[model samples]
Target: MKYDWILFDADETLFHFDALKGMQLMFERKGVNFTEQDFHQYQQVNKPLWVDYQNGNITAEELKHIRFIGWAEKLGTTTAELNTAFLEAMADICTLLPGAKELMDALNGKAKLGIITNGFTELQAIRLERTGMTHYFDQVVISEEVGVAKPDAGIFLHAMERMGNPSKERVLMVGDNPHSDILGGLNFGIETCWLNVHQHERPEGINAHYEVQSLHELRSILLA
Candidate 1:
């Protein structure tokens, strides 16, 4: 492997985080059928909250609560209760992305691995354990615990500190988001790989050092 340490984003990079499905499952437990229209409306409130969370303009708690406020009112439940149920539903459905296990297996002995996620603390650990991915990572940094999200250098610095201060040149940050994962690694002076599964156009100035469509492509590049 070219890099000594690999830091990954948890959601779409390693796991399939289907928020709509997870929300539907959550509401199903509450005896409500969450439709696509409901999910669309939820995203209208949730997406911008995620952006605000990443920009450090809001706390994770705030985002969690505010995004579910409408649903909570409709369901006659507290936002916190809805939020916990949503996370639980997400955990129940968690699975590794295609080739995720194979790539990790290929890289396990060759390089050290870690996860730096903007995802909530409640889901990260359980997903790792449930997916049997716990042993593959040496560090798991959640922005909620750090009080900062990705695209910010602070969270990256915190990750590096826990990693015994590995050389920036010898580290690679991989994720699916161009703004957070790519830009954040670039700002922190580390190599970056963007996992653009949807073939989205690269944003204006956020250039990743490498780009691949899937973990298999990444493994080919790294394990060659």
Candidate 2:
């Protein structure tokens, strides 16, 4: 079926976020004297904060501060220092996934494209703009901005509304996360595409309309 609008997820879908590795390297380079265990612990603290933020239980600012505060409490560091380091490291390593630009270019003008991500609006926008992907999207609906994350259906609804409410059958949702992107799109009655970057098994009972192992595969599918 032909789709009029294509919605994409950002982090794992469009960009490769080596969050743990990057944080470890950045701390070492900055003389923070943190161990890999510390980085892992920090990530453990940060992930749930993002989930909470996506669930609308916390503001973006609260999530940001909480991550650093939790890490600092664990590592005996100041929150201010941890926050600065985390932000700097995140900004430095936020690179696009391979073939992301090409796929976006390939889809350009062929179908309306937009971003529906469960991330901080400011950070998500900065990542897209910095990676030269800002212009490719017709709209970017961040969960933080919308007060709801994917799998909840509200976020997808927000994206659909922004896309002029294209027929559900003629809309495609693409992302890496099965829980968020795939399940969310299915819940919204839109076709879902799983960008399975890691070759993850398709979860039982939650099938994607399309499956791509890479961005190049996405381009090929669009061309087909």
The 10-residue segment of model 1 with minimum total lDDT is 68-77
Runs in model 1 deviating more than 4 A are none
Residue 94, model 1: Cα distance from true site in angstroms: 1.1
Error of 2 at 138 (Å): 0.6
Candidate 2: tens digits of C-alpha lDDT, residues 47-141: 88877765668876677677777657766877767766665677678998899899888888888899888765546767776788889999999
Window of ten residues with lowest summed lDDT in model 2: 82-91
lDDT scores for all predictions?
0.95, 0.80
Best by TM-score: 1
lDDT of 1: 0.95
| TM-score versus the correct structure, for each prediction | 0.99, 0.87
